[model samples]
Target: MQLAAIREARAAKVAEARRILATAETEKRSLNPAEQSAFDKFKAEITSLEADEQRATFMEDCERRALGDPVGDRSFSAVQRQVNVVEVIRAQMEGRSLSGAAAEFAQETERRTGRKAQGVFVPLSAIESRAVNTTSTAPELVPTIHRADQYIEPFRNSLLARRLGVRVLSGLSGNLSIPKHGTGTTVGWVAENAALPTGDMSFDGVTLAPKHAGGITEQSRQLIMQSSPDIEQLVRDDLSFMLAQAIDSALIKGGGTNEPVGVLSTSGIQTASLATLSWQNVLAMLQKLDIVNASAANIVASTKAKAKLAGTLKAAGIAGYILEGGKVGDLPAYFSNQVAEKTGTPNTGRVIAGDWSQVMLGIWSEVDILVNPYAEGAYSKGNVLIRAMATVDAAVRHPEAFVVADDLAI
Candidate 1:
């Protein structure tokens, strides 16, 4: 009876094992032929377990080994051995999806950063012709049209060397010609049309072979091999630095912190109770401030009350404006066009405006404001505010006074 009971248990275990095998088989059908064979072999080994006790022991051993437990003995039962077992199968499945997303993000970042170096060749259209030999029957030299493509290789090499942090060794190509006085011997030719910018020398392919003497490591070489993104980034950085320098130079050249030299006076307000200030009086004040340019005066008026006070001060030969209060958005337009019109400056001018308290708290506060002791009430309590700080010139000279003259508030 004990033997019979064991037989029944074994039969039940075999049925359970068959169900697992069927599932694995279904999975195998989705795989290619080679993978299906692997699955079939594993299935066959599992199916060979003859007793329920043996099958349970085998499965438990497999679970332990799959969980990274040591399998000290190799001669264990086939069912107990962990073969083709996957740990973190879910993570492996998700990894494939993540790889695609990562690639797209990297590409977009590169684009936004403007990390792409481009090269173009400007070909020489004409060259001085050599005199024809009267004694020999020779054809006239055909001038080749130079295309920018010829320079691409050297530019790419320079870019690659920069990315790899390797020193570049470049040489110019010599002109290709045989010496007229030499004894019938042919001299080697030189490249004639290579003109690279300063810090980038033209490379002559015929006369000089490209070579690196030292400092090339395995890692650097690998970097150069995949240097496209690095080259692009270098170009982007170079352009930004150049632009910043240009802006700074423009600002300094316009006038280094000099107040706009122009006049300021109010007009057109006359009443017994109110202090009288007229538009004509304001214009006269602007004129007294030495604002001779009409365009400068017009822009200040155009900007109205939002005209940048600092720009106006700069125009009037003052150290710039002290911003007590004003709208921020109008400041740029007010100053930009006026600076361009009056000073012949290009592009938008920069302005920094702040409230009374913030200006006092700022690190560069002293550069922007001044206190007036005589004014009354809120006007007397005004704080010197830096309305605009630009790396470029302001639009209008005495723009603030001009705005006042034009009955504009800015």
Candidate 2:
């Protein structure tokens, strides 16, 4: 499957190269600077296709080994692993010869793929007093991109489900397929030559494709420039916090249209209807994890639900609060505003209980910063607009590991 995509992508580059040649042929002139650069890029990408094919082969080898299928050559580890993707990409965009670690990466990649390095370029922006942060997409006068080095966001705890030990896969690319095993081989007593039952584990898959998610920040020149010495950190913190909030919100209740499927929307997950945030309901939700065989678990609920549980009695005649000391049913409980207070009838909140480790978060890219230094309006007014983004997806390894209730009353 991945090979087909690679071939298609390679063919596209080849066609692009052909188109460049064909255009020059029709124009009856030598290739222009932009045309030549594009042609070279396409050529480089074509060579890299072979590496992608090898990568697919390596993945297929692992799958075959796991499924006990007939396996072939296992020599798919290329030297590209030593390369720093960000540095190489940045160097390529700057049109400068790579040095140090980047140069070594280029040689290794080119040698392994038998072609010069090239790829789909993603703009890497930096924090600085530059015109790139103008108000518009295109800058005012001169067209130039932005830059930054080792930019970092302010330190803070991420309230996302990841803190609950969810499995996080980072720096991934292309389409991914995660194999799921269900019900291993069964054993049954066989009586004196009687036929035995045949049973084997059923298999399924959780697929993750690249999806784009990002936000834009528009800043006045004065604020980014003269307002503070650490404007960069402030901007970064804002972007990081917003991005993290969006991801966390999606983890709880994404609709799966342009974003990833989340806990409430994942198919086959356990569900229950609760009209009140009571001890019985919380216990019922916890019991849903019986089949999960989890060593520990956690509960995430809406703020209102937390409030109600914190004030409600454990039982009809119980003395203590149902939720005491930030714990519910002896399990730690957390409340988030992202838990969707406007769900179901009466616009109630949501509550989830599960072995959080079964949650899988796939990150295709980190916080990608893009800046347009030349927006006419921003340049003239001394303003800048910053865009921060990341591509990610979420899935559940075992739907049964989670129980969700949207009927929780505040």
State the lDDT of candidate 2 residue by residue for 1-410, as single tens digits: 57656754675576568657856864589999999999988888889997898799778677756765321223222222333333433343345665654354334333323433223212111211122222224468988543233334344433647667766665466678977776788889999989888987898898887677777765664435433324444454555565776777677777567988888888888887667667777777766665454322677888788777788897778698988988876678888776768655578877787766667777666555455445777667655545666778888777887888777677
- Candidate 1: where is the Cα deviation over 4 Å? 1-234, 250-293, 297-410
Best by TM-score: 2
RMSD to the native, candidate 1? 39.1
Pick by lDDT: which candidate is best?
2
Residue 348 accuracy (lDDT) in model 1? 26
